[model samples]
Target: MLTKKKVIISIAVLVVLMTGVMLLGNQEGAAEAENKQVTIEAVNNKVYVMVQQVNFIEKAAEIEFKASLEASEEGIVSSKVGGKVVQILFEEGEYIHQGEPLVKLEEKEAGNNLRAAESQLSAAQASLTSAEVNLESEQGNFERLKVLFDHNGIAKVELEKAEIAVKVAKANVEALKANVLTAQVNVESLTDSLAYTTISAPISGMMDEKSVSLGQNVDSGTILGKVKNISPINAVIEVKQTNLEDIKVGQKAKVTIGEREPLVYEGTLKSINGSADPSSRVFKGKIQLDNPDQALKPGSFAKAEIVNDQKVEIATVPLAALAGNEDSCYVYVNDQGIARKRSVIIGETEENVVVIKSGVQKGESVICTNVTTLQDGDVIEVVAE
Candidate 1:
């Protein structure tokens, strides 16, 4: 049989053990409750963000655009008149001015024609002189007959015949004069045709194409070559129709070519095509860029932007700060060391920054990045950089 004192001692030790177990369970429960608390950010939290001032106005705003560079004036040159090309004055890729002669036509035939016309004119002049001499002789005869008739030494009928002869000779001289005038006019026409044998440039530019070679026979109005003008380059850009509302005249643009240093240019929205591209639903706009060096050429791809009408100068935050879609933008702003989820009104949105219209004020810290992993009213320890 066990002693009664030993049984009582065992019961006391069991009660002490149970009390210690209860104490440990209570402490563990308290620690778990503290661990459930979320860690978040406050205004004092340090994070690097790119920031820009914005303009909050009653009307519109300015939106930045990215695009490439292009030239406006580009074309091919062609010939106006044609003949056997005797000489090409300019080499391929030579700069030429307006009215500069490009090719010389073989003027052998034209020269022969001119010479023939000149010979005909000379012959006409000789004929005119002969006709004048004949008229003078006939007039002298008529005058002598008149004298004879006055003295009654000649018959009236004979004097009348002499006078008729004089009149006929004078008419012949006048007809010969007309023929000389006609011959002179023919000479001038031939001379002009001879001048047209040489082909010239219509505009000042660099010769791009030279299709005719020496001794090549070409007809009138045949295309001989091309000249390209590369100055005051124009950039053609297509913008989304929805984005057109933000674009207007006299906007500044920055253009970049592939691997080329970016160029800062100013442009006046020269034209806006009313019709949208049928497949792309994009509208077309043109920007004129000054390219005095003739570096920009045609058929180059480019992009452009029209600075928004309104100047912007308001509080702005990083794009990561904004919550929800574009329609309902919100952010978690830090106020007095507490993270508060707030609804925000947005204005213009740039690449990485957004214009805050309302719901957030200047100098307020907002949770900019990693918003999806955050909760409302989270307690966060501010980490310093």
Candidate 2:
């Protein structure tokens, strides 16, 4: 009976030990599965991306706007006298200089009047010379008569008559002199009238709008043509009130024209309007460009980039790092290995880089690659470039 009781106790103890071992194994398996699941989740959540530190650079701020090219100077061509246009000296679209003759009118009537005045002046001068000679003879006669009267050789009446004759001769000579002077003035008037028959350019520039033709009649102050000085042309731009503070007179600017293989010209901000426009609330500005080649034409579309003289320190990032359109720009910045979406104010773009006006600090790591795939509070693994 004692042997049988001991065998039953031994089996019970072995069964209890086996149950404990099985329970421990099951617990270990569950722990391992939980750990594996956690590892998978961590791997799935982490994103691998390339990043670059934001750089602060000191550079001049630039503002760009669409502009129109215009002539710096313009002149209206007109005539001062009225006559029939006998000749047109220049054609439309011709380049002319100031005071260069452009048209000619009939001057036959003026020439005839001038010749008649000249003939009158010659006759008056001849009559004046004859009158002066007669006055000298009359004076001699009066002196001789006075000497005879002093010696009782001639009467006082004879002396008085001689004096009267001298006075008459002097009056005649004075009248002839007056007539000569009037004739001379008439000649000058006719000469000026003849000169007015020719019309000339008022300014040196490209001429256009030839209104008068050969045999066409024109009156004084008639619109003949227009001359526009295109060299050193002006690029007119409208600037908002907010931007006007940054721009100043004599600031450097760059102008671009055309699209396919565009042409660039360097210029300066020549002027700005004192007040803004009532309707648009913008100020008009002018950028003067030296166009010696005449490559830029007036009324052509252009773009002006004004560079401010003040240099500012600005944060910059790669173009790829930026997301969203120009209206609302944002970037993904890495904060302690986590991607944080940050909204930023966009500015001018340089080569392969963009200026960040706000929302990012210098030396902060910005995710450049895989930015679109990132979300706020995402775990990121920064990779080398």
Candidate 3:
């Protein structure tokens, strides 16, 4: 009975161990199947992309920069002479012409001085005339005395007195004539002072600012107002130092401002800075554009692009195909039905296309779409053109 009991217990232990081994094997198989499904899912995640066969374009190199439009002729119309403001002509913010009167100072005193100068001149002229008549009479008297003395009928003292009178009269005439000249100079000076009372615009523009009121006393160099010339306004561009080499004064450029069909304006490169800005490493440039209708305001933003004379035949690709920035730039090219990310040196852009300076060649297909989903060796299918 003991032996039979031992044989039943041993069979039950062996059966329990066999059941545990089979359960562990089934669990491992299920884990392996789950891992394999994940691998299959990864393999099925293919990105759909679009590509284009690019070619080289022969064109001149260009550089683009952004800046604002500044007034070409902006200055404060200051008081040239000090006086009380009498009349303020034209409204502030009104359009004024060159040399048009804007302000009138108190000129009553200047006018009175001018009249006084004129009276002094007239008195001098009368005195000069009387001196001349007296000189003529003295000469006649001296000649008569000389003739009488030659006949021994008059004393030599009378002739000497007549000669002295003639000398005194001539001296008086010269003095009066000098006084007339002095009076005339005073008249001219007073006339200029009176004219200075009427201050006019030195240039044609809108009155941008005013700093005076009627009946207010102002000193010389006081800013009465300002004129801003919008016609042929300045387009100021701050170009990067790297792009400053190709720009020159008098080169024609196109400027566009506003949005949704921006208005185009033709301009000439008016000036370029001699040195670069230390902080931004950019060179300032200026272009002058026409604004005949005065539609463009000062301080409006603008964009300027200048094309160099040198021509280059370089492979071009879409701007969207360039994945990185200027310093760390790259593009994706299709290599045997696979997307290969390539580091490229790029140049200027012409609208939607960009010139590939290096790392790309003519007749290569550039992957433009699905760029974000691509890897170095991502399988790609190019869309039909």
Backbone collision count in every prediction? 11, 0, 0
Query: What RMSD, rounded to one decimal, does every model reach?
Result: 8.0, 9.1, 5.9
Best lDDT among the predictions, by candidate number: 2
Q: Answer with 2 or 3, whichever has the higher TM-score.
A: 3
TM-score of each: 0.57, 0.63, 0.67
C-alpha lDDT of residue 249 in model 3: 90
By TM-score, highest first, what's the ranking? 3, 2, 1
- Model 3, which residues run further than 4 Å from truth? 1-50, 63-76, 90-94, 206-209, 226-230, 236-248, 254-265, 270-286, 295-305, 312-380
| Of candidates 3 and 2, the better by lDDT | 2
Model 2: residues with Cα > 4 Å off, grouped in runs: 1-56, 61-70, 143-153, 235-264, 269-287, 301-310, 313-383
- Taking the tens digit of each residue's C-alpha lDDT, what string does model 1 give over 162-225? 9899999999999999999999999998897788787778777767667877888888777778
Model 1 lDDT, full chain set: 0.71
When 1 and 2 are scored with TM-score, the better candidate is 2
**What digit string (tens of lDDT, one per residue) describes model 3 on residues 129-238?**
99999999999999998999999989888889989999999999899999989998999888888999999998999897788899999988999889988788899999
* Model 1 ranges off by over 4 Å: 1-82, 91-93, 228-261, 267-289, 304-385
lDDT (C-alpha, whole model) for all candidates: 0.71, 0.88, 0.85
lDDT of 2 by residue, 306-340 (tens): 99877878888999999987578899999988999
